[model samples]
Target: MPTRPRSSSSARISSAIVVAATLVAVPPAALAQSGEVNVYTYREAKLVAPLFEAFTKDTGIKVNTISASSGLEQRIATEGANSPADVLLTVDIGRLKEAIDLGVAQPIKSDVLDKVVPAQYRDPNGLWYAASARARVVYASKARVAQNEITYEELADPKWKGRVCIRSGQNIYNNALFAAAVAHYGEAKAEEWLKGLKANLAQKPSGGDREVARDIAAGKCDIGVGNTYYWALMSEREPDKKAWAEATKVILPTFQGHGTHMNVSGVILAKNAPNKANGLKLIEWLVGEQAQKIYADMNFEYPIRSGVKPHAVIAAYGELAADPLPIATIADNKKKAATLVDKVGFDN
Candidate 1:
């Protein structure tokens, strides 16, 4: 993990003195007494909690938080119009789209978000925006595969047969990759790639990205696909993870005319947020320099904002062209991606 720069909380505090003094003249005690907002998230606590803490420390807005990986949409649905959740944070375009489809999240008007995040990475109406991005890069075992030769299509070549390992096609990450395929190759060609790729796998699709790395390190497969950040995450968590990280290197694959598929960890404002003002504040704060720096340092994800470099581990992997297909296309073609997954029997 890269060293975290010192918190710029003082800079924020200096800026807030005038605002805090002005709010002191107001009658409402909500900004001072409770000084709090509530958040619901599907991401890991370590990845997002600090931002809320920083917001609290700077603006005096206490953040009440709940961290869960599943059934968030259902929980929000059950809460209905009475829900206290002010913000929603999570991954994958499908999850964000689900929030939009369910009408659980509301449009947020933030000039900051618009200027910092690309249009393709966010909804036109501002239902949500990506805070950070991860690419679906290939990892090749250092001993078995040489660099610069693998293309997306060539992964299915007969020479590489029984040389691949992947997680379940049902995984949202893989589904998004297929969605990218649909965008670039058309449904016909994308389905062909899925069918062919499925046939080349060395074993049944079963584990997450880190497991894919482990398989490659163990020689269970010579090559595999996974998000670039997982390798860094694993390496940071334990010494045992270093072997897997060292055994393989990241492959950009963007060299073959199309950039690799990418996804995001993003946020949306809740439709009936009890703290709507605070929600927008959070969104604005996230895309700003402070939170963007934390996201890059802690998660090994690329910051969506301009001028923010990737974390050191990610930097060590070198760089490549990202696929030009708009990431929003992933959400639009999601259904087709699923249909093709089924058509090609990808679950087998």
Candidate 2:
């Protein structure tokens, strides 16, 4: 992971922050206090700064965030009974499940969480709760593609040969989608579909989802797959990337007989949370309308709270009929999904 510049209000925990193989900045004493909550997150620091600032302003409790692109669960495990982390925040059901499977997360019994988050978007045992969601949708070049509708299975059609672009098939985002295919279509048909989709690749699978839109703008491909949030980020934040955003229209794709595939950015209560009370307070506040609004407006995600609307930018893509597949179902099949990706040589 590249080093992110530090924010004035929040410290960025980097390699230098570790001392004698232990994270030294956030000690258990500090975490146990009433004024602060410590968070170990896989989310980008910059993206979550505003929410933290707002949380502090709304309540007197301060938010101390440790950001890493990966390895958060392992770090907490290595810290053992002395870990100061109060909460774990991450994207994708795969990472959430990993935390539970690793025994680093404890089941949270919160009536607020149970009421605010939908059943399908949370763990049945309450180990994790999704704060927001993103759908995996198709990005089509506005000038070249005439149809507004498309299905995940259609990306494999022969007419789309050499015209589709995507990141690594082994990525968690893609893996979850592949897993969904398995849940809906069984292994044999899913593997056959994977082969067909790989045969249509415009280039070797590489780059992040935003690159799919960039390639579409450059006419490298006519259509590709990406998450809804990337398009919103490009359009709202990166001025130089506006052309790419303008080049394509987002089409919410569904499994042939099912609805759109969706994923989440979720929260978990650490097993060894030192500030358990403050941690619970923060988790409850996160699902409330005010925080959900921040998630929608600042992050371009669909809020998990019932009755909260998505930001206008996301709403423009049209309402999503998210596939009713439970996140746990998709997570359970992740290893099998990876196997199919390899069996079909998706990135080769």
Candidate 3:
């Protein structure tokens, strides 16, 4: 973790500070004088800075951010009731469920959130709300694969033998996909599908999703599984990576009887939020049209709010027909998914 000086405008606290259990106190006068909110997030600081800055400009509420890649949930658990965290923002339903299960998040009753976000993407008790979504889809080599359509079950076909690429099966993104399989198919069949998918691996599962595209561009594989946003990012922002993006086409693969699998980047209210009112305000604003556009466009994600279109680069991939499998159902089967991954030796 990197260290930076704290200031009134923004502060980047290390995970070390969080684990050390040292509560950084805001001076009583500062707290009373300026309406502010403290956020601990797993989201990249650069990705969220613009949103926070916009919020401050509009509402005069100062935003303090603590960014880390992992261990945020545990750190909050360690801090107990004295935690200064007002909100927790993280990607993936698995992590959000972890926070909820760890008792770090409290239920929120926001009419704005309820109206803006679809029920399928949010917690039933309102412990968390998804702000944006990304589909888990197939990335097929443009030169080798001519078919525009594919299904998740088709990846197991022997015809694709030694031609599939994927990240580690234990990764939350893949885990959720597998969990969805469990939701649709029984565990026995989902496990069998895992073994078949593993047997089709071009190489031992490794690297991030972009690497899958890179491999496809390099002729290492004909098809790979990855999130939709990575292709959008590679095409628009990463000039050096554009070739990788150009080498493949996005294929929204569906379960045999269902729509495409989707995951989200979500937000939660802290159980002991000191500035509850302002935190709620921030949450409400995040789901609004303007803020939703900024938040989604920054990362090439689809805004969860109705009536907001995805960024043009993402829209080019066509609209996502997200599988209606409840996220909670997937989260519940996460452990079963992980166990099946190891059972199949997917990373080996």
Candidate 4:
């Protein structure tokens, strides 16, 4: 496996990974930590480095992280009790549930977590908690789309036919959103909505959310569905993407009567975490005000903590009224949502 080891605890390097992949030959004893926590994350190493650095700075405990886009949960399972993974940091409740269902996550009970994160955003069994969130909202073209407000149901209206652009419906982000729709309206109604949304497609569902913005800017579509952050990132960061951002405005859409659907970036305590106490500390500290601030500014996501404000770029979109349905509820509907996606051939 390719390796890029980092030595500094204080460096803001995106490559803050000590060992970026699994250690097969080394025994679990060598992996033991006297004052460190091993983390397996689906999130990019650089995006999560500041949180680890802050945790280490405040408490003097080192963080050892191995980051991957996919299969870290399976890696932990393969390591079994020998797995040194103390905490799993990742985004989306669907993946969090996957960790739990794979038996890689253990239940946690933290008063700090319960108080800092709302009930709707955490696992009821305490297996995981959302540290940050991003809403699945429409990216309407400023030049073409006039309506400032939209409902999830409105994406299906006959008026929007040939105007919607989106990524694959099978994507975890869209899956979670579709699952939320199942929770709000029954699976049957959600199927109808999915079909209608698919009918509105200007082109076959392709590319990630940022590409959806590109298509809207290019006049391939008038509106598209995407997470809140990609637009914010485009607006503030990449000079090349600034045109895509400038051409569109975000609309915080909701279910007919309910609030906007929210997907999360959450954390889980490893089932056989070697340094359980340290892992718990890291988990709790993640929800603390300081870490939440990094999430707001650096990650460009909404802090799940009550008192934390969003980054100004995100705040400009307007207040987000997140749907009260528990993330677990949305997660429970994933299989059903995925089935509906296939049944409707939304990707085709």
Q: If scored against the real structure, what TM-score would every candidate get?
A: 0.88, 0.93, 0.91, 0.92
Which lDDT value does model 4 have at 274? Answer: 90
User: Using alpha carbons, what is the TM-score of model 1?
Assistant: 0.88
Model 4 poorest ten-residue lDDT run: 10-19
Best by TM-score: 2
Tens-digit lDDT string for candidate 2 (1-348) = 113444443233433322111121465453377798898877776777777788889999888877766667877887888888999888888889889999999999999999888899999888999988999999999999999898999999999999999999998899999999999999999999999999999999999888999999999999999989999999989899988999999999989888999999999999999999888888899899998999999899999998889999999998799999999888889989999999888998
Candidate 2 minimal-lDDT segment of 10 residues = 15-24
- Model 3, 245-314: lDDT tens digits are 9999999889988899988888999888888888889888888888889966888888988888888888
Residue pairs with backbone overlap in model 3: none
Q: State the lDDT of candidate 1 residue by residue for 1-348, as single tens digits.
A: 111122357335333111111111222222322465667776666667677778778888766665555555656766788777778887788888888888898888877889999987898788999988888888889998876546788776777889999998878888888888888889998888888899889999997888899999999999998998888887775587889988988887652577767788888898888778877887888888888888889878888988988889888777746776776778888889989988888877
Runs of candidate 2 exceeding 4 Å displacement: 1-25, 28-31
Report every candidate's CA lDDT: 0.77, 0.87, 0.84, 0.87
- Name the lDDT of candidate 4: 0.87
Our model 2 lands, by Cα RMSD against the true structure, at 4.2
TM-score of 4: 0.92
Question: Candidate order by TM-score, highest to lowest?
Answer: 2, 4, 3, 1
User: How high a TM-score does candidate 3 get?
Assistant: 0.91
